[model samples]
Target: MGKEKTKIRLRGHHLFCSNVMDVDGDPIYSARFCANFRKYQQMMADPSQAIEVVCTCGDTCRYCPSWNEQDGKCRLYDYPPNANRIDLEMLEALSLSVGDEITSGELKQRIKGRFGTTLPAMCSWACGFESVLHCSQGQRKL
Candidate 1:
């Protein structure tokens, strides 16, 4: 048998972003961010791989150009820290919380069940999130 994969650690809101958006070759995101996203996508290849929800900057943010190590949030909205606020909102929508462990398929199904026909309330507000598309049904901006 093949080696088992470890959990995919990501921020709370990134769970939704991963489900909705595809940023594969988008210039808006830095090359490092794009590369990390690809690896994240691959991590989901095993449906059983656990998705660990985090409050601080997770694997996805580690490679983001706008990542802020000092505050452990995105540089955009640094004053109000909307990134952290938005993450909490997303977690509420999904009935999840930081440190929670869930499978990718379960998270996807929850997303579909909760917001399949409507825009996520968290995404409805514009916080200037640099990488993930804030609107337009989660399609790639480029």
Candidate 2:
């Protein structure tokens, strides 16, 4: 993947993945995730906005609509305990030893096509709904 430029203000910002996914188990909307990704990369470039990560979900989680029927906790299953919030930790951990800044280039190479994309079904419904809601009147930005 080629080098893609990201903003500076959002650099080093990170967000933990919530249990927001679809039946097929793909990320529903990349907005929050991608936004954080951009922030992390930006922080890497500038080194001023270094941030930490927190794992709210404990472990062994995944979202499955049929979880109850399958005798499984699909919601928890969809979101693993510590799997989602590793990005910020990874960056903080990496900063101790690494001297050079982490560029979007490296991130792209690591995530490959997985970055900057949203699952089709989830994106259309959930993401679309969110986009509409965010742009709607009487709604405040959180």
Candidate 3:
């Protein structure tokens, strides 16, 4: 018998970015973003355990035109003493770090504090949804 495939359960914020596109203007459903997201998703599946956030810097930045591949950094956010830094400040402010287990509610609260809003509010500006249906309907929540 073949091994069963694990179903990846995604949260609300994950859903918000699930339909985001990549640099080539293709849906990121099967990309590294999904892989990384699944990693965290698996960890957070246990309600009693604290979820370990690998990084506060969301994957959406990878598709941004300003992302510099050569240096593995964002041109718009990187500066001296903070080279290759994405959302470090936000992460630190929220007291979140790699391998630190945290509750889902805690995670959501910190995310809200960092962005000063919800994922949908932020996605409206960052995500470039090519489909008219997605843009019109999806962006309405922003």
Which candidate gets the maximum lDDT versus the true structure? 1
Separate clash counts for every candidate: 0, 20, 3
- Candidates by lDDT, descending order: 1, 3, 2
lDDT (Cα, tens digit) per residue for candidate 2, span 14-101:
2212212121222333454335433343344343333222232211122223234343323322255633233334335334112234
- TM for candidate 2 is 0.22
The pairs that clash in candidate 1 are none
Candidate lDDT (C-alpha), each = 0.72, 0.30, 0.42
Question: How close to the true structure is residue 103 of candidate 3, measured as C-alpha lDDT?
Answer: 65
TM-score winner between 1 and 3, please give it.
1
Highest-scoring model, TM-score: 1
Q: TM-scores across all candidates? A: 0.78, 0.22, 0.37
Q: Which residue pairs in candidate 3 collide?
A: 50-101, 50-102, 51-102
State the lDDT of candidate 1 residue by residue for 1-142, as single tens digits: 9887778888877887776566666544687777777688777756777999987777777667678877776775334645478778788999999999999878877877877656666554644453454434553221
RMSD (CA, Å), each prediction: 3.9, 14.1, 8.1
RMSD of 2: 14.1
**Model 3 lDDT, full chain set:** 0.42
Looking at candidate 2, the ten consecutive residues that score lowest on lDDT are 10-19
**Which regions in candidate 3 have their CA more than 4 angstroms from the true location?**
1-26, 29-49, 53-84, 118-142
